[model samples]
Target: MSFVKALIATWHLSILIMFHLSRMRDLKSFYLGYIKRHCQQDFPKQLSYNRFVERQTSVGVYLLLFLNLRCLGPCTGISFIDSTPLRACHIKRAHQHRSLKGWAQTGKSTLGWFYGFKLHLVINDRGEIITFRITHGATDDREPLKSEAFTNKLFGKLVADRGYISQDLFERLFIDDIHMITKRKRNMKNSLMHLHDKVLLRKRALIESVNDQLKNICQIEHTRHRSINNFCSNLLAGLIAYQALEKKPSLDLEHVVSTLKRA
Candidate 1:
């Protein structure tokens, strides 16, 4: 296929994947039962399931990343950051899994230990994603904040869970003019927090709701991926799908703004 034709094919396949994910349909069934009949006019030529998968996987991560970025909602200065595990396979099959052999790792969360990657995400109080990064499960939550590239456009207060509470990380973000607010660990010293900050911290559950929507509504987590490329493609598609939702969890920004102003 010509370069332009290949690009179009990739884009069309991505749309199909997003459609599949958003509707929670079986991938193969969606392709055969719906896309082949209803979407035939869009394709230059018909493609078999295996060929379609091959072409879609070749579309590269950069394209999907671009699409994800394009769908991002505006930053509201108030942002929430969190990470969730993306398990590659059943723990029983971890030793036999080779598709993500070098890419995935074992990591522990509040729920427990799992073997896979971790998706670090930042979303505005509007419940729209600002940016995201994926890392090995073993990677520290505070590590991403160290990169200027990641925190470049992020400003105002960034809220996260206690896993992100580190004195060094807090100082680094403070130097960059981005205030880091996180819940204190039980053993840590009790420093006074602003009333505004404390209220926003109470609403950190908004991000958790976002995570639940991504996993359950958008189907970001699945063990049926056959290749790392497919795994990433599915994930990016799910993120894009979530972006298309008409309603999302959001904070009462008007109240937050007024409260901060009064204080």
Candidate 2:
């Protein structure tokens, strides 16, 4: 009846959350098949798919705030850090891509060259996400760690792969009371490390498991984004949905939780 009518902000967030959590692969199909068919009673005044696309930017800020305030987990002394590539398009199609042309870049990973951005994720031993940073695809894995605000909440021991190993980086974090432990590179000399650190370094795959769940289960990365705002909304919504997962990959830290708490 009225052109000015709009869905409530919470309703908008709920719909975005369902987009990533639902079985449907894309937002159009999910909105048309599921929400339009089964959710009309709950959202009778919802906008059409096209209009919803236009409204994504409105919720982008809200999604980020919700992530920082509600979805994120706390930093346990023992945490893991890792980076994953979020490809905007195949490397071959980089020249033709338009949606994220300037935003994305040509970067190299352990896998190879990809055209997109990088997601640096940090998680605690319990498989809970502590914080994250997104950067240009070419950004070094160690760059985010250089920021004080990024590592402020973290403490005690931080286990990471060799990619994060740098003498200066280690000393900087150590100055802030964050003891970073990583295996020395092939060219580096050996140094004495506690048995606990060695064991946790081997278990660094905990972050990998979280990465798998985020991309495969939570729909964290999709290549079909039509706009940068839409892409951000999708990623944030996926993280919110992930927070609802009952079971997450974790370590047997029951006995050590109290110990770390006191230390």
Please provide TM-scores, in order, for all candidate models, with all chains considered together.
0.91, 0.93
* Every model: Cα RMSD to truth: 2.3, 3.5
Q: Whose TM-score is greatest here?
A: 2
- How accurate locally, in lDDT, is each candidate? 0.82, 0.87
Q: What C-alpha lDDT does candidate 2 achieve relative to the native structure?
A: 0.87
Cα error of candidate 2 at position 73, Å: 0.5
TM-score of 2: 0.93
Writing each residue's lDDT as its tens digit, candidate 2 over 96-183 gives 9999978999999999999999999999988998999999999999999999879988999898888898889999999999999888
Give the poorly placed runs of model 1, Cα more than 4 Å off. 1-7, 255-263
- Candidate 2: which stretches are off by over 4 Å? 1-7, 254-263
lDDT of 1 by residue, 128-212 (tens): 9888888999999888888887888799989999899888888889988899898888898898998989989988999999999
Backbone collision tally, model 2: 0
